[model samples]
Target: MFSRQIIPAVAAIGCVLCAALSGVAASAQTSETPYWASISVSKVYMRVGPSMNYPIEWVYQREGLPVKVLRVNEGWRYVEDPDGMRGWMAARMLARTRAAIVIGEGAAEIKGEGNASAPLRWRVEPGVVGELGECTDSWCEFSVGGHHGFIEAERLWGDGEP
Candidate 1:
């Protein structure tokens, strides 16, 4: 009788463990939408819908350009570019790597340090995209091509948490 009771209890415990493990695996496959992502390809098309049968809304030629992912379905991501243009793109063409674009008018000065008092390193114009680095309350480190410097956090579209 003890052996019979122990067998059922062990089987029940095993079923519960399997259920919990499957739940964890399911959660790991998905992420919260509306996150920041960057274009991973040199050229990718933004479609009007989630599938290729949809009309092409735009063709992005730049890689590493930051976009805001508004939603995800199947293998497509609904994204908004720095220009505020929203469309759907293939999820494979986007990466989770952080990137930022210089926004606002004219040119933004990239300083050697995170403070204004630091020497100027570069003057990046609006629309210039680069990899994003650590950020403080007021400034963030930015890199374009081979140059790296700090710029005001407010000047970048992808600076803070998404």
Candidate 2:
């Protein structure tokens, strides 16, 4: 009968819609991975596992610190810090903005330009997080609080040129 054919066609359409929606959902989840993101809050806890039930492995106090996202779970992301420390942090605690942190023991010199011999603009201590800008082979322009200048690319934790 026509009714039977109509019922099956409607069921088929419903199935196709479900599949398309599920595919969209999966891609949405996966697209966030393997990207650079920064800490959104002033303090965030890095847990041993993806959930709060896990023990706190570390506490990051610096906002705008950049992290490399390795994977994503339900409302959590596995990230690696500049020190090569890896742990899970809440997904909502991170933002898509680019940032960088100064590494090494000494204060990193910020030059007026990318060239090493350029005029010295200022200095920033290690572990300071700042907004990251364009980077060349060996230097990157960064700004923190009210200061902006270029620093050696090797001293930062964000994306660096080869």
Q: Using lDDT as the measure, which candidate wins?
A: 1
Please identify model 2 stretches exceeding 4 Å from their true place: 1-25
Give the residue spans of candidate 1 off by over 4 A: 1-29
The residue-by-residue lDDT of candidate 1 on 47-123, one tens digit each, is 99999999999999999999999887878889999888999999999999999999999999999999999999879
Highest TM-score scorer? 1
Q: What TM-score does candidate 1 get on C-alpha atoms?
A: 0.82
